[model samples]
Target: MTIFEATGAAGEQNIWGIVLPFVLMFAVFYFLLIRPQQKKSKQRTAMLNQIKKGDKITTIGGLHGTVVELTDDTVVIRVNDTTKMTFERSAVNTIVSSAPAVAADK
Candidate 1:
């Protein structure tokens, strides 16, 4: 083949070699990091949505209490009989024990 044709073929291969690594890296990142993070975030959102009065929970900052009231963006926790504290809904970390399910009258 002519020198010009040879160089053109090598140039095409060179472009693919550079681009293939980037494409593969993006795929790896998506599977290993992005996907799991998104899944965990959804689970956390679901857990937060399920919060209700009387459920025991802990906050991200380590406070533990029973849920007393809930609002769109806040929760009032009863720390003790005479002590209650309000926290942002997003501050909740985990539900310690789910509240008992209410039964319907037969």
Candidate 2:
């Protein structure tokens, strides 16, 4: 092959070599960071959706309470015997404990 032809082939290889690292970096980031974050977000959303009355929970702000009420976008938590507070459902950090199921005395 001519020198020009060899240079052209090397140029094409260099372009790919430059792009490959960026592509691999994106793949690594997706798997190690973005994908896991998305999975965690989905799990958190499911947890929030599953909240119900009597379930004990903690908020992101460190408040502990029992779930007293629920709406699409909000929750009412009973923090004490006489004090209940409302918060966005997303504010719940985790479910501390699920409510005990009651069986009917048939």
Candidate 3:
């Protein structure tokens, strides 16, 4: 009778042992993968909202230009003295330099 009861208790503990590892794995994934991605997305949205005219920006496709105009969905980028291209706001990867950086550095 003692041996049978001990075996049943051990099986109950084994159920928790299996579930604990899956719960820990999910926690690790949330911290390592999901959390950082959410943070980066928020930061990118903030950057896009803060964009203004004359900011030097680079696109995901490697186009670098100065922002000339901003609209709700598009930005006009002057790539050269006389050439300009309009790109979607989401196409901008980062602002390479703000107006302050241009004036203060040189």
On TM-score, the candidate that comes out on top is: 1
Clash pairs detected, candidate 3: none
Per-residue lDDT tens digits for candidate 1, residues 1-106, read 8999999999999999999999999999999999999999999999999999999999999999999999989999999899999999999999999899988999
**Candidate 2 error regions (>4 Å):** 1-4, 102-106
Identify the runs in model 3 with alpha carbons over 4 angstroms from their true place.
1-11, 100-106
Model 3, position 34, has a per-residue lDDT of 100
TM-scores, all candidates, are 0.90, 0.88, 0.81
All candidates: CA RMSD in angstroms?
1.5, 2.0, 4.7
Residue 59, candidate 1: how far off, in angstroms? Answer: 0.4
CA shift of 12, model 1, Å: 1.0
Cα error, candidate 3, residue 26 (Å): 0.4
Instruction: Report how far residue 73 has shifted in candidate 3, in Å.
Output: 1.2
Tens-digit lDDT string for candidate 3 (1-106): 6999999999999999999999999999999999999999999999999899989999999999999999999999999999999999999999998875445565
lDDT of 2 by residue, 54-101 (tens): 999999999999999999999999999999999999999999999998
